[model samples]
Target: MAEFRCRACGQEGTWVYDPERYTCPACGSIDVHFVVFRHELPDDDPAAKRMDELATEEANKRPKKESED
Candidate 1:
């Protein structure tokens, strides 16, 4: 999975695929951009995991925000 940052809220998250067209959860913006990824187990970064967890948690807590037209 790849990590991404929402240009709208500056919130970070992980994606199984490119999130270029995905909308930001915090501010409902489609200006999301890919950040980085984990390549090795020993290199497992806590921040990345935290972002993933926060993303999932936030997603579950809020309604799906629609993409801006």
Candidate 2:
């Protein structure tokens, strides 16, 4: 199962294997998304902003690593 949260209604939960329809159980909205990729959310998103803060903390705690690219 994958963690999900509907962007429209803010409903968060775990979803079963991928199906033809990945909808929110609370409002049946199609804005559901995996929580793991929340870091990829728009910069204005709260979750995305938090991820950026955490990343900055980690980077500051250690020596700068080479770019993945």
Candidate 3:
């Protein structure tokens, strides 16, 4: 399972895969975004170190863009 947030209503929680459709459970909004639940960097792992550097500090805190009318 992965976490997701409803961009329209600011609801955040874990989500299971649904083959039928993807919609926010809070307000039934299709506009939603993913959330990373964990981040770890192992000293003995080179790949983990590289991933830590590549990951954005504000990946989850980014402001949503306004939709054009």
Candidate 4:
């Protein structure tokens, strides 16, 4: 079991899937990334969900890039 998030919509979900072929559950987009949680707990564990939220917060806080000439 593994958790995944959609890059396009920030949608989070879980699936027992191949990383190469996984798609976002919310929008059916292939633009997604894995979110590692715990090895002992299932993908839907509350802790995992919380961790995903924190990760998203951190990403949102990152500085934006300047435009190149």
Best by lDDT: 4
Compose the digit string of candidate 3's lDDT tens values, residues 1-69.
557789899999887634344678678899987543334323545544655656655555677668857
lDDT comparing candidate 3 with the true structure: 0.63
Give the TM-score (vs. native) of candidate 2.
0.41
Which of the numbered candidates is closest to the native, going by highest TM-score? 3
- Off-target runs (Cα >4 Å) in candidate 4 are 18-20, 35-69
Q: Rank all candidate structures by their lDDT, best first, as comma-separated numbers.
A: 4, 2, 3, 1
TM-score of each candidate structure, all chains considered together:
0.33, 0.41, 0.43, 0.38
Candidate 4 displacement at residue 31 in angstroms? 1.4
Summing lDDT over every window of 10 consecutive residues in candidate 1, give the lowest-scoring window. Answer: 35-44
User: Which lDDT tens digits does candidate 2 get at residues 11-36?
Assistant: 78776534344577678888777644
The C-alpha stretches of model 1 lying farther than 4 A from their native spots are 18-21, 25-28, 35-69
| Model 1 Cα shift for residue 67 (angstroms) | 51
Per residue, candidate 4 scores C-alpha lDDT tens digits across 1-69 of 778889989988777655345578678788988764356455676765777788789989987778756
Ranking by TM-score: 3, 2, 4, 1
Q: Identify the runs in model 3 with alpha carbons over 4 angstroms from their true place.
A: 35-69
